[model samples]
Target: MDVPALLDWFDETARDLPWRAAGTTGWGVLVSEVMLQQTPVARVAPIWQEWMARWPKPSDLAAATQGEVLRAWGKLGYPRRALRLHAAASAIADDHGDVVPADVDTLLGLPGVGAYTARAVAAFAYGQRCPVVDTNVRRVVARAVHGAGDAGPPSTTKDMADVAALLPEDAAAAAKASAALMELGAVVCVARGPRCADCPVFDGCAWQRNGRPAYAGPAKAVQKFAGTDRQVRGLLLDVLRDTDEPATKARLDRVWSDAGQRDRCLDSLLVDGLVEQTPDGRFALPGEHGAVSPRG
Candidate 1:
């Protein structure tokens, strides 16, 4: 594989993501990694930019309350990730002295950080010889290398080896190649429909030669939200997130109709650390500049 050529192509053609730019601080990289999890690049861009602008360092974020973090997170969904990121910032400040750890193990130890996130920080932030495999990277490797139409749900070891084998010898170059492959997969080798005509690895792609095969495995179940507990949770959190002070149960009750389901959702939020019960028995976002009763 012409690893250098691929990286060279990446250098020229890769999306100019704010987090991937020259001199992006490690904190910025960590924020981008968390926000990009299951979220699209376009959606992440402005939010990520706002985050980095507001809290340029881990210590800055550590100084913020969980309410601030979740509010900043907005409607990106999976609000637990915002809480985890806030916890991770505190860990970085207290343990690592506010520096994002370059070691994969240390990165993995951070709250909500996982396999792909660890390798991303190691390879992208530190320029280490680590394989950074997200969904996009997996799809590219599956089609271009193995001729598979799509990757099965993540099985880490095998996928890591496959990506490691493609990396160049030089650590920095290998990291750059990892980013290139991920970019190529995300933009040109996309699932559902691929733009093979624009692919950099088209000449050597195995799936292109064999003709793209249709995925036949069991499709994962999709979540429904119209009248589910999740929608109720969202309604409750939305009111809490927008408030300057803790909201009364009366205000929260207005968002969802069923009192039983609404109370259940509120309890769940308390358990999730997304909300807290105030001293006055009202509910507010966790750390929302007001006192709250400790969780049971």
Candidate 2:
């Protein structure tokens, strides 16, 4: 695949996200990577801007309490990510002098950072020429390069190698190519309703040459949130997060009517440390007041 040409396409068409602006810190890139996971870019932008304005560095974020973290997370969904981000910030402050680590292995050791994120931070944050593959990138690669309509389940090693092979020898060019791959997937080579007419690689694309066959490997399940445990859990958490003091069990019960389901969701939240149980049986978010300063 003519990666340099696609990078040229990106230079013209790339979305002007704040994190993509010149001089954005590694911490900004890290936060954007985390928030953009399974969440839309439009939804994450304002929140990311506000978050960066408030907590510009890992040390600033590490000083916030768990309760504060979750409350600030708002309706992003999957609130555990807030906890994970908090924990990662704590690690960065404590272990790395509050500077976000540039190496992929070091990033992998941080809480909740996986292979994709580590590589993303290395490539995007540090210009380290690492491959950064997301679901979008996988689909783009599968269809364009391999002639498959869509990727099956992700294989980290294979995805990394495939994307890495397309990178330029130059580090800065490689980072731009990584972003190009992702940007191509995001705006042009979308999963549903891809704008093939606008795709820059149409001439050489394997899928285009092969007549764009339908994905027949395995049916992907469409995610539904209504009337599910996840919905119930979100509701239960909302009740606790809205209040400062612990709420009575009876108060929490009002959000969802099904006795067993509500109890199950609440129990999960309590178990996951998103919700805390008082000795008096009231529920609240964890209430620690102070944070330990990182070593100089």
Alpha carbon lDDT of each predicted model: 0.87, 0.88
Encode model 1's per-residue lDDT on 44-140: one tens digit a residue: 8999989988999888998998888899999888899998998899999999978999989889999999999989988888889989999988888
Instruction: Give the TM-score of each candidate.
Output: 0.95, 0.94
Candidate 2 C-alpha lDDT tens digits along 1-296: 87878988998989999999989999999998898888999999999999899999999999988898898888888899889999999999999999999988899999889988889999998998888889888999999999988898888889988998888999999999989989999998998899999988888899988889988677878899999999999999898779877788999999999999998888788677788777666778875422222112
TM-score computed on alpha carbons, candidate 2:
0.94
Inter-residue clash pairs, candidate 2: none
Model 2 is weakest, by summed lDDT over 10 consecutive residues, at 287-296
RMSD of 2: 4.0
How many clashes does each candidate structure show, in the order listed? Answer: 0, 0
